[model samples]
Target chain A: MSFNVIGKSVIRVDGLAKVTGKAVYPQDIYMDGMLYGKTLRSTVPHAYFTLDTSKAEKIEGVVRIFTAKDVPGHNAHGVLFKDHEVFCAQKVRRIGDPLAFVVATSEKIAQKAVEAIEVKYEELPAVFDPVEAMKDEIKVHDGTSNIIYHYKLRKGNIEEGFAKSHVVVENVYKTSMVDHAFLQPEAGIAYVEEDGTIVVCAATQYPHFDQLEIAEAMGVPAEKVKVINPAVGGAFGGREDITLQIHLAIAAVATGGPVKAVYSREESFVAHSKRHPEIIKIKTGADKEGKLLALEAEIIADTGAYASWAINVTRKSGIHVTGPYVIPNVKVDAYAVYTNNPFCGAMRGFGATQVPIATEQQMDMLAEKLGISPVEIRLKNAFTKGSETANGQILTESVPLITCIKKVADALEMA
Target chain B: MKKRGKGIACIFYGTGYGNGFPDVSRAYAELQPDGKVAIYTGATEVGQGAKTALSQIPAEVLGLTVDDIIFINEDTSITPDAGTAAATRQTYNTGNAIKMAAEELKKELINIAVKELGLNSDAGLEMKDGKIYLKILPDKCITLAQIAAKQSEPLRTFATFTAQTVQIDPETGQGAPYWPYTFSACAVEVEVDTETGQVEIIKAAHAQDVGRAINPKMIEGQMEGGFAMAMGYVLYEDLGLENGRIWNNKLSTYIIPTAMDMPEIQNIIVEDPESTAPYGAKGIGEPVMIPVGPAILNAIYDAVGVRMTEIPVTPMKLLQAIREKEKQGA
Candidate 1:
């Protein structure tokens, strides 16, 4: 199929602006009389804290100091659950939980005020491991189990398929928690228009969701809020959740002036979400001909302090546990557990990135035990056009695993 | 001693907010007075070339050049909600929505042309290069600007596209949670320094079923960038967390792969067009990264005959594993 523009490599619409250093990222934005905002987070991971903001309020350029009491609307916001707190009212669940927000006339003043705010806390026991958090003795969230969600998939009978298998390979795999490390740190500017509409300009993956969230936090109608996205540096799923949008909006509305907040590199690391650290135990069985027969896998993921996209991420891991092959009999259990560790949310691959670290190694192990080559074994069991996934989704079209495998293999051979 | 080996891996990924989430994208198309069209959508570009790719959809449908269309996006009040740019969904979801809105606007323009030119029917009419013409007659044509000037009412359209997916049953985890899953594979060759346990990637060959190639160069860029990120995921880029606090929060301490660390990369794009997608294109953003990590790990195992069960396989961990393997072999 030939066309004028669809397939052609037209220059990027954002190319000139980006290359010319003319693109205005959130950090590059500045407004007249804009107050700088900074957050005061908890020093202890789990604690009951008493905040004294009197000194911060008395700072020379300090405009306003906001605590849990100043928030007009709901203090909680999250992508999946409304459990994350805008300000820690009673107990701090994680290390970076916001205890207070300080707005000042300058970034230096804001930093000074944030440092002046005194927090006295009584530390509590914290569980950092997902497996240990599952014991429910020390709950990440009080009065609830730490096992946030569990997803299970059952296909054919596992015992029978394993019994028929000539060789079985089992191993445990682990992946670490990593940062998105997008070039731009979290930054935004928020101000109220003359007609009482709050406008937030930020770097984000979704501006509409930000509008809704900012409105919800301000106890106002959605129509009263507007969000504009400037040129984003990078996201890689890091900007999918809330960052400085809500705090900036709240500060702007309270002070009745334009407010801006830009997280430093350290603050950005402490504030945003990380990729889930996963532990996967997988067992694969194949026949003498190297055809995959059955699989049993268990995955436990640390979702950290709050439920972000844990339900979807772990469920995705469960669905793709069998990899790109037809495993007739499969049993998989995936869990997203909450711990006192840094919160884990969306990343580039969501949950599918971690499973291949296990499934692919299992395939190679099975191939080695069966006296077959890696490429040959995968070819024998790769999903074709009519293959059914472990989750019972029948791929009717565009199932091109074999073609991709062959293309890579052929390219490698040529190289 | 240094050892060399090769390994391969494959993966399949479902696009959008699957599992029966109402993955919807909305867009608006307004025909300007000068025959130019404006597309308004809430899809943020996020440095992924979404604006370029999405602008092409309306341009293709309206028989105009990319420069002829005004791309307005990411303002909540002005543009309709095109969903988030994550989930690798902008091109497929927002592209389809823009295409639909543009198609509707095209139909309205053809109707105006039919009445203005006194055409017998709209069946033989074709739009190309800013003109609506009759295919039967070589020269019976009217400019879109002329039709715009003659219209009594303004020409505008709004469209919404929702991907079809069945929710997986909560208990059984059965049912189709996603529509139009994308597939990919990768092969990598590596050299492992046995004494120090430092592994260097020699070359990487990757292939993805992109459904259709909207822009082959952009797809290649995505593939190459995804490979580098995935390589970092396996070898470097550790957050260094201890008891919930990031010890190495600075960029200097938490090492990401620099340009010097990248290996030679080869991208193979397979165009197996998805029938439901825009121009038969599926998202390749996230799928390209999924297979590279495993392929690199598999190559490491093949090189040294030691299986690494954990990631960000720093030289220290690899050395420890190699020592343990040697102890067992002895």
Candidate 2:
């Protein structure tokens, strides 16, 4: 069909509404008899702990409070591994661990009540290094050792591939943990109706996933819980996981009333998930003619206190370590090691953004040794259809990596 | 190559979300008794013009003016699921649904006009702006409002779609994940100060295999936004953490690209239409940022003969690389 408006750059439908301050975010939605909710966070970095909320529950205007014991369903929710606690019960892992949820008549009273909650902890020396955290004796988590998940891309013989190369470049690159830092803080209002249906409206990216997790935490049927995405300031994959949705749900169901939970900017920084800090060791090999042969690398990702899709991050980092190229042989050892650092989850580039810094730079270094431009070396090896990746996966679909590379090469005239 | 250079970089990301989830979508359009065409869509405009896309798709479908179509969006009670407005999927996935709803309205209008006017057994009739016109006669016409009023019927229908997104094998990570892949490339030219190691992007161009330019100006905005973000990733943005807490917690510590940081963006949108898209269109959001980082770093290497292995090629890293060059010279 011919489109008159479809192909036009018309004004955003909500532009005027948002600009006029009429756009209602979750925080803007205020209902009658709504109580303020706040979470008590652990101060220690790592330890086994028990939080008693008796004193805080007795504070004036403090309606009700919930520890992990108050949660009726499973106490954990994570994308890959269900390891994170909805509320810390037996142990405090990270400094931002939520130990108790307090409901009060006002935000000021809730803040005061949160200070009254007492948490007992046996402090343990924490490990923040991705490499050394894997060896830490003080298990931050309950189950396995620090190594959460490992991903590998094993193809042709790596040693033989390097042997066939005229040049081999090795370098280690590191990227710090990055927060999504969406302008909107995590805000949500949760209320349980008379029919036992829990309604949670929040600034979230994934509504369906939030609905499922909120249902579990609320101890209700999945159909009973509804999550509506408010005008999210920005997500950048930050709000993909449930933040205030389940917590508000727990607070509402526990206190038996409507409750609003808003994370301050400082609280958001401490509690929210971040991009996995990656330490990637890249080793690239190219032939005399600048044809790439192999790229073997070891990558360690700090998954932090709990596993929050670090399994997939490790997997992606393992595959893209060789990058969008043709390599007859490639081996990538990618590990998501548990650490005392902030929890790491998804970001814009997934995990591929970190490795390119290493692998692409190695390509430039190899190009130098081969007396060729970095563009020339990449063009010679850019993966087209029929080229097998390091994971033994052949590109039968759109292998536009070379085409994209050429377009950019042409755009810049990097001949 | 001239010292002042231009380079191209192709950045491609399979923009549509992965395949495993339910690819559900629906859109409804109705002509009110007041002669206004209202289109109902569940696509949320998270600053990306999904409402305008909805308004446009139906206008093109039913041959109505864009101004005539009142778009009702992002309300599940009124609008059906057109899917989330992420991944640049609105122009294609939501577009097809809106087209179907409009087509149904067109068909119903033709039927009503054919039955009422006794027009030559309804052959070669075209619907334009809520009016049924005879293709052969070229002048015979009746307003849809009149036909709808005469027929004593409401003109409302819905269209649903399941845009195919084949999921990749979880192990190998290779599959035709996107229904139609949107391709983009960027080339950036940067000049580095030899002494201070300050680098500035001289020129930047983005060429995207957009399947179709749904809106060239919108694509330009995406390109400009991506460049700003990539500029931040290249020369500004960083997450400084100490112990377990982030040191750069505020804007004073963390910096993003400002207005002064923007370079002249040459946005080239290529449209080799995909058969499935509304007018052969694909998602083009994430691609804008994906390639700019490498392009800028590569340019830094060209400007100064140092390969910046890490990101935010800040003055310190550039200066240190320059110092290493000085040591070699000595």
Candidate 3:
């Protein structure tokens, strides 16, 4: 219980350098002869396009222009799936999809070169709603259904438990798509070392994963790539996926010099992943004594453009749908549907943040119907030691929901 | 006309990459010639105090202050893989890995000290402030640096920690997918302007079972930050996406909470330590934000008898709901 450093509030180890403006973020890093890199993104959401890099290659300071054809290895990278293309070769799924990458002597020249490249495309009909996309009428990907992933959970029996309940409350809840807004926009620098190793310095949540991903996209061994995270501005979950790390690496490998890229605020918003917007339809049943009986819920999430962390996010939703209470009979179906909206991945709370809006409200409604208080109803049904979850997992240790509830209630003078 | 009311919400969240994911972390610890320690890991510190909290673990095991430890992290070549910093896993996963490596180094140093002192057995040996001493006799002590000079090989250790979890059955969705689930509760008092449908939080109270508080100040920082983010999620932050394009891409248009918008917050830390964690500490990063949204929404309903189903409950939407409720009452 008592110790030297375990529970002490020692000042942050990196606090001095950060406070004195001595912390070197990725943008602060400048290498000699570092060419500026920029990507030409698609303007249309859905299209089959032909890229013309002839004009871009003729730019005055443009060193090289990389299209999908120039990729030496697999032209795709994603945290969960390899569905996101490094450069949209033939078809573009989202408005911010990369069409070409340009490395130039200066940032201004890179921008000019990116503008010089042309894309001629045929736009296609797109689905923007997850519910509508689930009909499978319009496919985001060519050969797959619009439903990216679906998870179902069945426990005990929903019908009999619901029939035995004294009261049932049902409502639909919606949560909006939001960004991490981590203050600093994405920036990175990459170059080759003396021993034929490509070193990338960036602001990321996982540098080891970036090393593997960059190596895979560059057609090299994992050891051929090295990633170092500078002083990160912030990353709630936005930097969990690939950003400018791979692009900078590929450009550096091609140019055989350092390549640097920094995303503007607008570009950061359009390029990175957002939190999934969820539509949850939940029905909760409880006995007259305030004990939760059965729960049935349907959750649909919009995983736009590509599947980033959709599978795990939606599965987490289904698993935590019943909240912290003990619901014996449960039937839940969660789906991550593909759409043409901005892609969604991991956020702070992952998938669990959205459902409590409905579940907690239902508990209040149930308490109102049963002529009891909200705190009383929750305390009656909240999980304790040895309680079985909706997923049949037994809560053995550190089950302190009741204690937390009491503490909060006492602080609010509601106890 | 303003009405004030109180509401409460609670949550239980699982830590780490559950559902049979590997969820592993590795760390390396070395004893330098100067007797200072070096801890290497790949856990990225995204301003969440990961480097500070992780350094505390090795220092605690080796009986050294945080200042005496050289923390090296977030580089792929030098540091071993400590997994991603998401899933709130760094403090539990990497902290344990570094502690194990430091424990190994500690055992080796004790062996060296026992041999140098020509003791019959390595008993009652304790390390503190860079000195190895026997428990009963205060005078019998040796500096760790002196022990380091006696070692034939450099003292270095590597350790890896893998969390145990079972994959859920696809058909039934029944399994112990996560271990050591964290719990939290929040209560908020809100004042609602009935005419304009404006809601202001008067006061907020939050309590979390942190498993153990490695740094209480950092835990409070996380709690306050989480409250601000959840407030934005429920009432202010909205990405105006139209036809796949973000219209309000700039921060000026897309609003977030400022310090002035925050109300007085009461953070209550409860320690119900997880037995398997390092120093009985679990992650408090993500769980702090989970209970705020619903608690604020419930408080709004309590203030005014209206149930707003959608998020970022703008004044326009709340006013519309208020008008509808008045119409029904009439």
Which rank order by lDDT, best down to worst?
1, 3, 2
**How well does model 2 score by local distance difference test?**
0.73
Best by DockQ: 3
lDDT of 2 by residue, B59-145 (tens): 777777767788876334355667655555677787888888888887877787787667867788877766787888867888867
Native A-B contacts reproduced, model 2: 0.32
Q: List model 1 lDDT by residue over A1-415, tens digit each.
A: 7788888888898999999999999889888887899999987888888988898889899999988888789887899898888888989888888888899989999999999998999999999989899998898887778998989898889999999999999989999999999899999999999999999999999889888888888899999999989999999999988877888888888889999999999998988899998999999999999999999999999999988899899998998888989998999999999999889999998999999999999999999998888889889998888888988988988888888899898878822
Q: Regarding TM-score, does 2 or 3 come out ahead?
A: 3
Per-model CA lDDT versus the true structure:
0.90, 0.73, 0.90
Ranking by DockQ: 3, 1, 2
Score residue A141 of candidate 2 by CA lDDT.
Answer: 77
Error of 1 at A292 (Å): 0.9
State the fraction of real interface contacts model 1 keeps.
0.85
Cα lDDT of model 3 by residue, B57-146, tens digit: 999999999998989996899999999989888999999999999999999888888877777667888899999888888677888888
Each candidate's interface RMSD: 1.1, 3.5, 0.8
TM-score list, all predictions: 0.98, 0.86, 0.98
